[model samples]
Every structure is written in structure tokens, then in C-alpha cells.
Target: MEKKELEYIHSFAEYVDRFIRLLIDYSPKLVSALIILFVGLYVIRFINRLVRKIMVKRELDPTLSKFLADSLLWALRVLLFVTFISKLGIETSSFVAILGAAGLAIGLSLQGSLSNFAGGMLIILFKPFRVGDTIEAQGVVGTVLEIQIFVTKLITGNNQTIFVPNGILSNGVIINYSMQGNRRADLVFSLSYDTNIKTAKDIVMQVMLNHPKVLKNPAPTVTVRDLTDSAIHLSIKPWAKNVDFGDMSSDILENCKEAFDAAGIVTQPFVREASKG
Candidate 1:
């Protein structure tokens, strides 16, 4: 009986040894698959980082930077995931098809959002305006406070915050006031026709030259823009830094009035002609 028991144990051990050999023979394929997955994931992360660095170095806007980074990272992650799955002997074509169908559905549902995003890309690449720049678009005039993927925040002269869709802002005409670094301060002054036009012009020019904010290089211009029945029109064009626009405008007008008063030049007011007297 002892001899029979020994033989039984030897047979069981031989079966176990055969199973171990079979597993060892197949381990290389499993190890290769795991290695491929790990390497693919590492490459994806590295490529994503490289793309972000490149975009940031291009001096792109902050909002655009984030958008591009996320897009590139997502694309790389999807590619790595597909490669890893394929290494495990799984077909990726069906997975890709499903993802594509889902993406199409989501995109259709969020058409407005996608439009704004596309508009934002155009604005960023073209750079029509930037934050803190005063712009007039679609009849809305304000200083840009923030630029987002879908909307732009603007603070109007009256201190009200307005959110404008990027799609509309990008499609419409944009007039940027702060792009030139200086603004032309325009002032129109009218005097009685009896007043000497040349004298009035000299007084206006002198006032502009003496003002602190007026630029000296361009020189202020005082010209007769038009002649009205009741008044001689003088158009005063002064070049001033953007920061000094408000002060320079107010000072020029006030000084023109004072100088005209000192010179005894009487301002004239418009009068409508009586109809069919």
C-alpha cells in the first residue's frame, strides 16, 4: 500500500510540473504586451508635454494655451489607450467607431459651444484685440476685461460688465482704440462770424501747445473745418497719450474758452431758420 501511495504522489507532481512549463512558455507574450503598453503610455505623456511647451513658447494667449494643451493631451491619451488595447489582442476599430459616433452626437448637441470655440481660435491666432484694450464691435464699445473660449467680458465706459459671445465678436468689425498707443483728441469750437478767424486759430493753437498732455512732435492742428451761418467753425486736433485723453480733452476745451474770453471772442450758437415766414 505504501508503494502505491508513492506512485500516486509522483504522478500528481508530474502533472503540476507540466502545467508550470506551459505557463512559463506563454509568459513572454504577456510580458511583451505589458512592456508595449507601458512604453506607449510613456511616449504619449512625453509628446503631450512637448506640444504644450511648444505652444506656450509661441507666446499664444493664456486661454488658447490651455485649449491647445488639453486638446493635444487628450489626443495623445486616446492614441496610447488604443495602442495598449491592441497589444492585448483587442480590436480597436470598433472602439474608435463608437467614440467617433459619440463625439458626433455631443458635437451636434453643442453646436453653439463649438462655434464659439472656433471663433476663439480665430481671434487668438489673428489677435484683433487684447485685454484692457478698448474696442468697438457690433455697436458695443468697451474695454476688454477677459477673453474666454465662448465669451468675452467687457467693461463699458459707464462701468457695466457686458459678456459678448466670441462668435459674434470675431465675425463683426472690431475697432481697437488702444492699438495705436495714442489717441487723437478732437475738439470743435465755434465763434461768432464777426470774430477774426485767424486770431481765434492762433489762440487755440497756443492753448494746445501750452497744455501738459498734448504731444509736441505731431503738433496740434487748428483749421477751419466748416463755416456755419451763425459761427466760424474751428477743428482742433491734438495728439495725446491714451492715458491723458480725458484730461487733455477737458483741458483743451476749458482753455480754449478762457483764451477766447480773454481775447473777447464771443461764441456763437446754432439757430434754426423759421419755416415759411
Candidate 2:
């Protein structure tokens, strides 16, 4: 029994000595790999923080700053990962080359999406339009909801959301409806052909002038714009603050009735074509 115990101890000692030697032999490589990994991670994190600080200091848009920071961090971390792999005695040159080639192929295949991404970057940097701004683009007019990396979201007056690619938005003409501070309201009123043209114009002009919300600085213009076969057409032009446009429009039509009654001017109904029986 004693000899058997001694043999067991001897076998255990051999096993411990082999493990120690193995650890020592590979210690330098393992230590170097660990140091490289930790330092790379630290540097990447520091640089990411630094970039965010600079972006905040520059007063970049929150969405844009977040996107840019994430993209930069991802790129840095990928590079660090490649370096870490190399430190572990892995030949990553071919791997990197393959990744680059694949990326290029994918990018080429998705040129439209890539263009949108680039255009989105330009939009964020240049800031042609911002969230909540009313704009007309790509035959869609709405308020901006979000400006993402590849697309812009808009909420229409009808409460519909639209996603427009940034490529078309940036490349095409964008009419910022809210940028001009004020908007012009143009409305046409048709009166009976026999009705007094002068009276009709006077009534419309008076209605516009009396409106409280209407801007008084730019005097409203009322004139006989066209003469149809059945009616005398009068055009009413007024300028009002953008925010007041809808309110003024709704009130103007209602006020015209009172003005016309006071002036004794009558309007005619539009006639529709009759189909052949």
C-alpha cells in the first residue's frame, strides 16, 4: 500500500511539472496577446469618447452625432480585432483582403443604397432641413419626423408617415415651406356674370382687411383675374405668418359671406358636364 501511494504521488508530480513547463513555454505569447488586446480596447474606447466630446462641443445634431460616433467606433473595433488576431500568431492579411473585396462587391451591388447613405451624411452635415420643419420633396409635402442615415421620415397632414430615400431628397429640389417665415394665401371667388364686378371685388377686399389674424403689413390685393362665360372671377391675395395660414384660410371663406351680403354681391354655382343619355 505504501509503494502504491508513492507511485500515485510520483504520477501527480509529473503531471504538475508538465503543466508548469507548458505554461512557461507559451507565457510570453499569451502575455503579449493579452496586453495587445487590453491596450487596443482601451485606446478604441478613449478615442470613441473623444469623438463624442468633440461632436457635442460642435453642437452637432443628436441623431447625426450618434450615427457618426457608432460608425467610427465600429470601424475602430474591427481594426483592433484584426490586430488582436494577428498578435495570436494568426495570418490575417488574407482575411482582411477577403473582407475588403467582399465589402467592395456588396457596396457596388447596392449603389443606390450607398448613394442614399452618402446623401444622408451630406444632409446631416449641411442641415438643409431639420425635424419638425415642413418641406415639399419628391411630390410629398409633410413635416419632417426623423432624419435617419439612409432615409427621412415625414408626417403628412393626413397623418400618414412617409419614408423617402435620402438620395432623392438631397439631390432634388426641396421646398422648405416653413423657411420663408410667411406664406401667401391665394383664393379665387366666382360671382354671377350679371353681378357687379366692382361690388364683388370690394366685398372680398373688405373681408380680407377685417380679418384679425391676417397680416396688415402686406396689403391684400383683390382684382378681376379672369372672366368666365358664366361668372366673374375675382382673385384675393393675402400674406400671413406660416402658423396662421390655415386659420386665416378657414376664416376668410366664412367672412366672405358677410362681406358679400353687406355689399349685395351674389356668387354663381359651378356647372358640371352632363353625360349623353
Top candidate when judged by lDDT against the true structure: 2
State the number of backbone clashes in model 1.
0
Could you tell me every candidate's TM-score relative to the true structure?
0.76, 0.83
Tens-place lDDT digits, model 1, residues 58-176: 87788788888888778877777787777766899999999999999999999998888888888877889988899889889999999888898999989999998988889988989
- lDDT of every model, 2 decimals: 0.84, 0.85
What ranges in model 2 sit over 4 Å off? Answer: 1-23, 270-277
* Top TM-score hit: 2
Error of 1 at 95 (Å): 2.7
